[model samples]
Target chain A: MTGAPLLAVNNIEVIYDHVILVLKGVSLQVPEEGIVALLGANGAGKTTTLKAVSNLLGAERGDVTKGTIEYRGERVEKLSPNELVTRGVVQVMEGRHCFGHLTVEENLMTGAYTRTDGRGAIRDDLDLVYRYFPRLQQRRTSQAGYVSGGEQQMTAIGRALMSKPKMILLDEPSMGLAPQLVEEIFEIVKRLNEEEKVSFLLAEQNTNIALKYARYGYILENGRVVMDGNAAELAANEDVKEFYLGLSGTKRKSYRDVKHYRRRKRWLS
Target chain B: MADLFFFLEVLIGGLLSGVLYSLVALGFVLIYKASGVFNFAQGAMVLLAGLTFVRLTQILGSEHPWDGMFVLALAITFAVMIALAFAVERVVLRPLVNQAQIIMFMATIGLTFFLEGAAQGVWGSQVHRLNLGVSELPIIIGDVLLPPLDLVAAAAAAAMVAGLAVFFSRTRIGRALRAVADDHQAALSVGIPLQSIWVVVWSVAGIVALFAGLVWGAKLGVQFSLTLVALKALPVLILGGFTSIPGAIIGGLIIGASEKLAEVFIGPLVGGAIENWFPYMLALVFLLFRPQGLFGEKIIKRV
Candidate 1:
């Protein structure tokens, strides 16, 4: 791990539309050139945490009511999302929100909107993305909406890569994909971290896949981090194995293990 | 031969007017495409731009058409439109960000009434002549005489549409715009500023409004009635697909040519004034066949 974390979320609290609290005191960090995963199920404030770091919560009428976010040791809680991008932080939102109307290449091009480095550099990066995602290159001219779900997910990640970010805040990269596709994407992510040197703060519900790749992991539940540790440590935890990994020392959970293995003796019994 | 010439003239005239309708609809498409707001106030924006231009020209002395007043008034009126766009973005859209699409639509409805009243109150409800220096005299071509003013207006509209089409397809800013329109959250996440794009789109729509206002004001005379031209564009938008730029132009052309042909040929058989309601009937029928409109993205259902 690097000497200092690349990105830090210091006890942030997010509230939507001034009423509903979403993320409550969520704190996490991504070390430089490290893959850190934020693990959770639906409504566990996983997406909200990533959005807070990227400063994208404002558009959804969401406010980071408390705490500060730091990127490269500079406070970035109040910067506009684009400014954060300029400073080398990009977020690939969940649902693979590729521009449905645009061609795959065009969707990737939009990622370079704020780039003043001229077309040549952007073009080189585009070719780089195509190299990393050969499937995207094959479907370059197709409308993104018409592509398979896996391709759309790849396009979303490829779009994020177009920005040439120092760090990526990727939310639910494996959502709604098949097991094979999920593993394939995580594999590409690991390579990007190693080769491109882009730090990632990944949010995922697929705990088994995430723990397999991520160097560190934080488990969130009901708007707060329930546990956090090294990937192997988190993977070996008995509760994590039972709830998230679905592996109570078996290839798959049997009916009894999944349902009611803990039927204990009560006073009446 | 004489009947054919007359038919040709009617067709040409209708097509020319239809291009003007497309001009107004183009403004709506810009805002709608970028931010998903069906800006009902586009007509009001047209009225304001027309009034602002005509009054400024008179205030600066209208006799100096080739020299001082015309270009100066146009520039000033365009500035006013941009400023209005900025103000609307701040006052109307900014607060209402993330509100339901229907609520935004309704806000634009309120904006329509407010702007209509504001334009009249500020400029006074007086009819003013707007001569864009295009000669009103008809030009004879073979057996038919064509109005030069309508021809000029059609050319201007064509040029603007071409420029916009190229800008959207060829430029980075344009791609960013489409991205913003497709998904605000994703756009922001990828570093496209949602609010800035909104302001730019509204401003571009404002520029379009200025051009539309000038042409329509010249043809119909600048007055309260100028706002009603926005109504003509509605049928055009429905036919073109509210989200597509080329659809607006094509829709406008279809509406214009058909309504005129229908009015001329079918009017005698029926009562008359088919021009009054023909476009709407056509648009209604089109909705039945293609709800997304020509060139509009198909509405995909998950079920």
Candidate 2:
């Protein structure tokens, strides 16, 4: 990994309709070949943070009000999503935003649309993607909409990979996957980080697995980064363990461990 | 049974008329493909083209005659259509782009009325005979004699359809138009000039309408009522799918043949005027089974 950071997101405030402020004073840094997890409860502005990075905020009716995102030491806050894509910053959106009508191949080709590279290179990339997910190669001709959820998630990541992005902003990659599939998806993410050396800023509610894979983590609470440190440090913190890790007592659950939290539990204190 | 020859003759004549119907229908498809607007102004554009053709020929002088005069007149008309297309794109479509689809559609209808008024004000209310300079002589093959005018009309329609098909498939701009039809946002993201594409589409539509005008005007002469033929293209659109080229051609052929057959066989039984309603009824029937039509892809909306 390079000593120079690949992406530096400064304090950014995002406002909605020029009135309601969704995110206030949010900042994070991601170095090359590193995994950074943005952890938050629902509506805590995790998705908004990713959208701000990818320039997809405008489509969802949100705008960055302050600060800038620098990629390769160049300002990119006001650049359009299409422009950001050419600059090698891409997003595998929150929902599996596959072009439903398009075939899996066509959907992937859309990723390399900004490339003027020869067709052979595109074909090589397609083969590389298929190697990562053999199931996708088998169903390459099928329309994306008909794919199973796990396959759709794979397709979304594969599509983003076709762009050969230097960094990927993955929003909730484990959102709706089954337990086994979630494990499989995270394994692939880990493999991608290790093998491809691609940087990732993953926004996930699946904190246990996210923390295991990330080198660093940031816990966002109501649009503010309440805790930011090395992944091991944040994971071991008692407050984070209670609120995010779903841990109780001395015996902590392993990855995929699920324990429910009640809002009234805080009220008891 | 004794009227078999007469029946065949009427069938042939109606088929010729169908070619003209398809031509106008092609205009509707061009605009729909490029801008997703079923331009109601197409009918008025037809009437205006006929009027303009006549006025230009008159100014060119009677000595030059319509044969050479007609081509020169069309060149001038082409220039005018380009200007009209640019004006429509700049004035109507650009401002109304982000507006609702129905609002943009209604605006085109308003444009139809405006063009109609402008045509009358400029060309004046008069019926002028148009001779496209094709021989009035009929080709007699055995008992079946085909009028040269009908032959020219059908040939012209075929030529235009072929030209459009080749242009769309072979040219980059045409492919861009197809891309625009596929996804407007995607097309815009690719750096395509959306407003300019609209202008090109409308200009092509104007040209198609003018071609229909020249042929129809030569057969029935130029008159304001000729604009009613544009309404006939609606059934064509319903059958062909809004954006398919081959669909337009096939749809036009179907409407033409069916309307002719209905008028010949069914018109007598139903007190005539069946020609006016047959295409519409066929379109209505097709819509009942396939709302997207023969060639149109089914649309799925996501919330």
lDDT of each: 0.89, 0.81
User: Pairing residues by index, what is the TM-score of model 2?
Assistant: 0.75
User: What TM-score against the true fold does each predicted structure earn?
Assistant: 0.96, 0.75
Q: All models, DockQ values?
A: 0.74, 0.14
Best by TM-score: 1
List candidate 1 stretches off by more than 4 Å: A250-253, A263-269, B300-303
Q: Tens-digit lDDT track for model 2 on B1-303?
A: 547767777778777877888889889999988778878889989998888888888888644445676678888988888889999998998777656778888998999899889988998888988866678988876566778888888887898889988877555467557656766654433334567788888889989988988888887788888788899888988998987778888888788888988987888998998888888899989999987778875663543
The CA lDDT at B106 in model 2 is: 95
lDDT of 1 by residue, A53-149 (tens): 8888888889999998888899999999999999999999888988988999999999898889988999999999999999999999999988999
- The per-prediction CA RMSD against the true structure, in angstroms, equals 2.7, 5.3
In every candidate, how many clashes are there?
A: 0, 0
* Clashing pairs in model 1, backbone N/Cα/C closer than 3 A: none
The CA lDDT at B295 in model 2 is 80
